[model samples]
Target: MTRCRLCGSEAMASVVDLGATPPCESFLAADQLDQPEPAYPLHLRVCTDCWLAQIPPLITPEETFKEYAYFSSYSTSWVEHARTFVDDAAARLDLGTGAFVVEVASNDGYLLKHVVDRGIRCLGIEPSVNVGAAARDGGVPTLTEFLSPDTGSAVRAEHGPADLVVANNVYAHIPDVVGFTEGLRALVADDGWVSIEVQHLLTLIEENQYDTIYHEHFQYYTVASAIRALASGGLALVDVELLPTHGGSIRLWARPAEVAGEPSQQVVDVLAREKAAGLQELSGYTEFSARVAKVRRDLLKFLITAAERGETVVGYGAPGKGNTLLNHCGIRPDLLAYTVDRNPYKHGRFTPGTRVPILPPERIAADKPDYVLVLPWNLRAELTEQLSFVHEWGGRLVFPIPELSIVEVAS
Candidate 1:
């Protein structure tokens, strides 16, 4: 009886099922490992009516985000990406000292810090108190609440409407697409800008990115689906830019529908591109399950081969995608050993389901593992550069998605 979250239709077709898996962000402590952990159905469905690829919420947002372990500031590439976005957006929007900028799900103020540096008025709405506290400590004013239609109206009333609203990588995470989009419409000024970045479904299906299908990501979006979700909430897509972050993502710019806004050629072209790619049809999603199964098989084969060769294979970055890949492939600690992450929060914890110990990045230099699996392959360039020293020991980097590959980095 699970209806489509966006269009409320019963005509949903199964796309790909990742099986039952734990929440990707739910890192476990050593002592907690003895206790039973619950896993829920990690399946994706495409609405035959609206063509929005989605998954039912296995766990509530309260359970997933209450004490979040993932912090946006942990990734150097992501922080730099945020800075670049702020620089470009500020310049293009002519944001000045008096302008207000608001970022939804502002994890640890990674983006708003740049806004504060420019002396522009900025506010951050983060649900997790832990991350929100970090934002406040970093000197960015943060409200520890989720962005719903109510919160958005209250924020706009209390602080005045924002000139720029940023919701990076959050559109897919929101289960109530209508509420979030409606809130977005209320948060931004009529003439202001709203930027939303979501992982593109076209890229996910094309690249065999089944690893991106975790409970935290409630839905996947095509440009057409994104338009439907936004239009229902009184917003119109005005522009879009495809980004390389998170495998492949699209940054959509929006304005209130009441405003006389015309979508840019970029928006028009991407919609056409999706249609040409057959994303407008259910047939596009039908074959994805078969592709995902092949990825799992290939990864296990590579891991088993490495183990047989007596090579020590460790992972770099215990990201959500990493958990999904590991859990889906049924990879245990025997396969990956341990993964290193820059974030200290996950340093002593274990990856959900796989139970792979998460160590510090320094462990790579000390252990000199034979191969390091770059889990967050979207940031492969950044990780490869940071761990390039692995080449000193003839170590190679492995990528698990889009088929497993051994990368030999030049020193």
Candidate 2:
């Protein structure tokens, strides 16, 4: 009888249960192996009242982000993405010299660095100690604590309300969605704007991207649900944009309820599409769970067949999504010799639950495995380009989820 975190609605339906899984990024230290790992039931539920998709009994932010290992600066595409966001936002908002830009959950100041370079006053609120230190090193003033109503009030009192507040891929991580959004209300100036980007639930279901289900990400959002959630916190959705990053994401621009701004056509169009697609109906939830089960079956069959044929398989991108997919499919080192990641912090560590060793991308060249399983399928194009040398050795790249396909190099 798990109730909805937002509306306290008991009329909820189970979407997909990922079974018990370790914290997606809890990469193990050598000494930590002696202790038993803790895994929780990863189940998703949808509320009929609010149409919000979330997990049962949310974990605390401190347990989720403190000493976080996932760094945004490691990925080249992510860095470019952040730069583009900073450039576009600064231009659109006319943010210049005296304007203050605040980024919530700013990992290592990836986007904030670009803001700082433009001679604007920028502040980053990061909960991760290691990441906050990195931001500090880059000369971005950072606050190392979770953003709450009290924290937001303190920031407003000290530095005054911000001109632009940016929260990229953080809307889903916060358990107290209403409180966090209310905090935004407290910290943003009357004329200020707040921008948030989250993985679109409509796209996740349509694309069968069940891999995005991890403990750190407690909720999935739709524009319809988001507008309602924000409105409850004294904000209004002013505009929305579809971004290609992270499979598919929705970038929403919001302002205080009293501030008048022209709502973008894109926002209206997307909302209509969501409603037409029955995003507010219970049937949409039913279809998503079925699609997810099919994905599990298809992926498992491919792995078992590959293993029987004596084909060597390895994985690419030790991302959190990849961790969920691996654990859900029950994939271990036996099925995957090792996985490669660009992040140095994860290179020597073993993936949670699976215990698959994460190696540097260079290892792929040395081993020359027959098949490389691309985990972060959203970045397939970028990863394939980097691992193009595999084609020279007659090896093919395998994409497991959504469908099983072997990408052969064009001669």
Candidate 3:
């Protein structure tokens, strides 16, 4: 009986139930471990009405981001991606000293720093206190508040409408899709554009990326669904770009509906591709749960076998998606002795449900576990390169998503 968050449709179909899972980003300190951790049902439903896939908002953003641990700056490729976007956007928008830029969910000012470096006026709207403080410390002005219609209007009134607004991988995290999109409309100038990047649902289903499902991420979007969501808030989609990040993502460029902008061929082409993939129909999502169930079984079988063979398994990168995969598989310290992360914030903590202790990357070499599970498979190449030295000791690397397989290093 879960209703769609976007369309207010009660005729939603169950996609996949990932069972009970703790908030993916809720990394725990040692002191709080003795108390019981709360877990919520992680289920995704597709609205037969709007074709939007979503989960109920079981947790609030204020609680989820209070002391956020995930910092975008920790990923080198991600930072470079942001810099490249800034360079291209600045040139494309013909931005000068007077032009203003704003970024929503601007974690740690990873992208806004480049804008400030270019001598442009920029402000970041971020709700996570730790990350907002980090952004301020790094010389980027930021407001630690969630973007809603009211906050967005206030920001526009105080700072003037933004010439360019960027929201990367944040659109899906919002529970109030309509309100968030309306906020985007409010924050941008009439002629200004808003760019949002989200993981393409086609890739999620076709590529078996069920690990991306978690409480923090409330919804998934296809080009059609995105257009519908934007249109609900008086925005028009004018352009689109497909990116390889997060397995596959679509960067949507939108402008206020009142201002006419020619829709880019890329947008039409992507929409066509979505249609060809049957994104407009219910069957496109109904079959995904079966595929996801297979992946879950395969992963559990692999882990159980590894344990039976007396193999010491550990994990690399304690990402939000990693927590989902581990919690979905019901993995605990018994299956994964510990996980390592480069981020110091997560080093001494434990993952939410599985309670897998997170240690520094140096610990991977110190323990030399028989196998290293690359939980963040999206960065497999980068992680494999960093952990290549493990091969010297006959330790293997494994990726559980898409399919569970051992990473074969180039000979």
**Model 1 poorest 10 in a row by lDDT:** 254-263
Model 2 segments more than 4 A misplaced: none
Candidate 3 whole-model C-alpha lDDT, 0 to 1: 0.90
Quantify all predictions' global Cα lDDT against the true fold: 0.91, 0.88, 0.90
lDDT of 2: 0.88
Q: Write candidate 2's Cα lDDT for 1-411 as tens digits.
A: 378877888988888888889989888876676789998889988888999999865467798788888888887888899999999998999998989999999999989999999999988999999999999998989999898889889999999999999999999998888899988888899989999999999888888888998888888999988988888778899999999888899999999989936688999999898887788897777777778878888878877888999989998889999889989889998889999998898878899988999999999889888989999898877777887889978898988666677898543
RMSD to native, candidate 3: 1.3
lDDT of 1: 0.91
For residue 230, model 2's alpha carbon misses the true position, in angstroms, by 0.9
Q: What TM-score do all the candidates reach, one by one?
A: 0.98, 0.97, 0.97
For candidate 1, write residues 1-411 as lDDT tens digits. Answer: 279988899998888878899999999999999999989988888898899888888788888887999899988889999999999998999999999999999989999999999999999999998999999999999999889999999999999999999999889888899999999988999888899999999899999988898999999999899999999889988999999998999999888887837889998899999998888887677788998999888889988998999989999998998899999999988988999998999999999998999999999999999999999988878888898899999999998788878999988
Backbone clashes in model 3, listed as residue pairs: none
Question: Which pairs, if any, clash in model 1?
Answer: none
Best-performing candidate as measured by TM-score: 1
Residue-level error in angstroms, candidate 2, position 42: 1.1
Report lDDT (Cα) of residue 72, candidate 2.
89
Q: How accurate locally is residue 159 in candidate 1, as Cα lDDT from 0 to 100? A: 98
